[model samples]
Target: MSLVSPEYIRYFYYGAIVIMIPFIISDLLKKKKEDKIDGTKHFKISVYNILIAIAMMVVLFFLINSNYPS
Candidate 1:
């Protein structure tokens, strides 16, 4: 049995999103409570997190789509 099967990779992809949800939510909540002066900092962090998540998804898609011998 291969460790890098599609099923396992799919699970990992889902898990990564699930893990990222809390960080996103917290960043939003924090941004809402902060003053305008600090808004840009929080916004930058939120955007960075979102970009990283997107990059991860793209990488995972390629990993899942690639054909490998079992």
Candidate 2:
């Protein structure tokens, strides 16, 4: 091993980044009739999603690490 394996945070980072595409697409097509176009809403949603991803990372890391002890 060269150094610390980023495998620890790899899943989380990739997953969170991957979600941006769908989020952006939805935001672009979202209407203002039923729901006004609110940049704030999208921003908040993204932040919330990021936080959830981080939390999930912790859970996943532990869950996976526990199975394969090094």
Considering every candidate listed, which one attains the maximal lDDT? 1
lDDT of 2 by residue, 1-70 (tens): 2156666577767777798879765764563222454434654565578689889999999898795756
RMSD in Å for model 2: 8.9
TM-score of each: 0.46, 0.39
User: What C-alpha lDDT, on a 0 to 100 scale, does residue 16 get in candidate 1?
Assistant: 88
TM-score (C-alpha, index-matched) for candidate 2: 0.39
When summed lDDT is taken over every stretch of 10 residues in candidate 2, the lowest stretch is 31-40
Error of 1 at 51 (Å): 0.3
After superposition, which runs of candidate 1 have C-alpha atoms over 4 Å from their true positions?
A: 1-35
Give the worst 10-residue stretch by lDDT in candidate 1: 35-44
Query: Model 2, stretches more than 4 Å misplaced?
Result: 1-39, 67-70
**lDDT tens digits, residues 7-62, model 1?**
58877888888999898788787785773756457766777887998999999999
